[model samples]
Target chain A: MTATAAPFRAKRVLPGFTLSLGTTLLYLVLIVLIPIAALILKGAEIGPAAFWAIVSSERAVAAFRITLTAAAIATAFNAAYGLLMAWVLVRHDFPGKRILDALMDVPFALPTAVAGLSLTALFSANGWFGQVLHPAGIPVVYTIWGIALAMAFTSIPFVVRTVQPVLEDLDPSLEQAAETLGATPWQVFTRVVFPAILPAWLAGCTTAFARSLGEFGAIVFIAGNLPFETEIAALLAYIRLEEYDYNGAAAIALVLLGFALVLLIVSNILQSWAARHREATR
Target chain B: MSAPDMIAPGSAATGHGRPARTMGARALIGLAVILTLLIVVAPLVYIFARAFSEGWQVYASNILDPAMLHAIWLTSLVAVIVVPLNIAFGIAAAWAVAKHRFPGRGVLVTMIEIPFSISPIIAGICYLLLYGRQGLLGPWLGEVDLQVMFALPGIVLVTMFVTAPFVAREVLPLMQAQGTAQEEAAVTLGASGWQVFRRVTLPNIRFALLYGAVLCTARAVGEFGGVSVVSGNIRGQTNTLPLHVELLFNDLNAVGAFAAASTLTVIALVALILKAVLEGRRG
Candidate 1:
């Protein structure tokens, strides 16, 4: 009995276990892990002193600042707008609802370059929105605002998609009971619903932020690419690469990659924590 | 507080704790609609508006230009090679991570998804640092007369990296939910592993696989930053459609760029429609 139990615990019942996992690991190594390892190695070769000198340079600092500010702005807008969109999609029925739902995924489907081109055109001085905005004491393209808008456009789906399912799956009975207990509509949402979706919302915002940090293709066209003003960290890294400044490129890239990896891990942790908390409540 | 008025059991269920009709509700709906129009639909409409602003003949000629044709061909070629390879990787990763209880399964799943978080530009930088002329394998690649960077192979490799997780992300959850019971039952009845997978698992996950494939195809066709890093933006040799759009725009050929962009926009619209349909089917 002991020998049988021990063997069962140690062994997998499924066939092709090794084959499938081996293939997965091999592909992951060749395509994903090895390249990342090379980047890290390149960063290491730059050494801590030179790396600091590169990353802390004035232009690098300004790029990081602009990227962070724009991403923060984008994430903040999505946090509010995304919750509203999710709430509308899940709780309400209206004409064009299906179209609206499908349009939420356009950012994911649209190429970033096209998105940038379209956005820049739309907000340029003589362009559609630009014609309106430029005279109204507002301008969008070729500024930090343009960068944020592009970031927002590209990352809107992250927040909405994350929160939509959680909102949909929320039990209506909880809200019903809260209403029966004399909670107002606002109170019911704040007390009962918001708590339920908060973790997922936070996770979504984190991913959106990380995505905005790394957003390049959609931003450059509209960003004006001014050193220390409009240039983002990712574009700055690309510029470094173009100039054959391998150390500069690798250093900047490592920081952006580090932010992405950390944000990703944080998002994953929040998501699993949300899952576990939901299970416990159930 | 009017709680008593709202206390009707069936009524409360229908409203989900809100009034059935309220000024606030209408306003919220209106706000959502307007913002969606401004944020999502306006740019989309702008693409075609500007694309054909110069008239139909110019638009047609832009799309038919030899360079534009090559860009289209190159983009499609990359997609053709990338989507199927990613589908294979996605399935293998899903099968392993969802079905098996390996010691490092969670880490492996994370590894597979690493590309999703990292920027495409960073991904290109990684590859460049590993394979460029002065990179780790640069000497070896040069010695072998193999050019992975600034060429088709480089484009494909980076695109593959970016789109790797889509199929797995879509399929893994469904496989996990379906569980090992049916497969074990098949095994008990003397079916081989391949037979069990084909007769039992594949049928269940086919829609999910297709969903992932659609998504993979869209990303493969649309990828820009990562591919740009490696492809070196050669005029007729390696310029993909997205890069070509950038080039035309920089050349002050706004109409041509938008005309080219309209084609990609059409692809995006079709992809969105397919995704919506697939989501319904999967559900």
Candidate 2:
């Protein structure tokens, strides 16, 4: 048995397995792992005291707080609106539905800088939306709201795309049976539909939140970058780099990285939970 | 699974009764439309409006400007270089992770996806810490007179980092779904491994590969934050189109900025259209 197992392990039907896998590992290490390791090593060299000092400063703390808050707000909006959008695209047939469905990816395809510029232009005091919104005393540009708006614009695709396929794949018979049993529309949705899509919706929201947390290009353009106000952790790291404060930049970046890592882990866990729930239901 | 039948048109007569459109559903659709328009469509329109606001002659001149032309060239150059390298890496990684059962398969998949979640700004910072003047190899690199930070190579590297996972992410699932049956069959029929892959696997995954490349091109062309951090914003030197747009805007060359921006916008739109077409074909 040991001899047979050894020979089987040595045999691979496809050639170049070692070459392909070796190149893959080497490339991943060179491109992804080493650079990330460099970041952690730099942070470590700075030590905990200096790292804490940099990240715990009022400005840094404020930046973190604002980034988190804006991301939370954006994710909340996406959670509701993204669900609606997915439902509409999946359940309702409307004119221009395909066009609208394609449009959902514009933010993903468009450069973040362009999104920021266009958003800032439209929301500034003299721009189109600005003229109306500012007159109504609802200033969006150069505010945290602007930051959140940009975040929402760029990250909304995450929620929409994630929830879309799940919604499309949902068994219509389940809803039909519920309705046939004398359930109201609200009851059918809340009892049958909502439960089926909740895990994906939650996963999508978490991913959107994660993405918003790290948003830099779009936010920096419209965020006004007022240290404790509109400035985000990412911008702060850029600022530190500009000031030639490597330690400070590394420390702040490490914090942002920490947040991203936590979010990614949470997102993964939620996704697996979603997959497992789907399997159980099946 | 007949699932598509349930969602397709004529579902009303398909035994599973389609829910009648209610007032709430109408309102929901309306709200979704409005939100999408406000959040997604309006800005896209705004870019073109501003681009053409200065008339065609100005737009024409901005596009023809040597600096703008250089920026466009650099952006293409980055995409040209980065996308193929990423395609190779993606193919390699996906081939290994999807086709083989390994002990650390899950970890490898997660690691490949790490860049997707990490901020581009942080990605730039990581490269900086690795290759900057005062970086880990800074002293050694100075001896060799090599410049990796604030240069074209740096910009390309960072753009590659940000767009790394696109093709892999697109191709992996499709390959996994297809399995290795066809390749195994080809091998048993005495076809070479390369021939099996080139003839069998490639045809099956070609659309996915193209879709991935299109997305990668869109991203590499539009990448801003990571490029910004590393490119040093050297006018007519390291500045890609996006950075050039930022520079023009900062210089208050609104016409030129929007003009350059419009070019990038067109690239994005075309990429999207291609993606949609490819997706339709795949479906």
**Model-by-model lDDT, in order?**
0.87, 0.84
TM-score top scorer: 2
Docking class of 2: medium
Residue range A158-225, candidate 2, lDDT tens digits: 77766676676678888889999999989999998889888878888888888899899888778989
Q: Over the stretch B199-251, how does candidate 2's per-residue lDDT look in tens digits?
A: 99889999889988998999999999888888888888999999888888888
**Which pairs clash (backbone N, Cα, C closer than 3 Å) in model 1?**
none
Model 2 fnat value:
0.55
Each model's DockQ score: 0.50, 0.51
lDDT of 1 at A254: 97
Q: Write down the worst ten-residue block by lDDT for model 2 chain A.
A: A1-10
List, residue by residue over B19-123, the lDDT tens digit for candidate 1: 327777889889999999999999999999999998999999999999999999999999999998888888888888888775677788777778888899999
Model 1: per-residue Cα lDDT over A1-282, one tens digit each = 255445544666678876887788888899998999999999999999999999999999999999999999999999999899888877877777778877788898899999999999999998989999999989888889999999999988887877776776688888899999999989999999999988878888888898899999999899999998899999999999999999999999999988987887788888887777666544
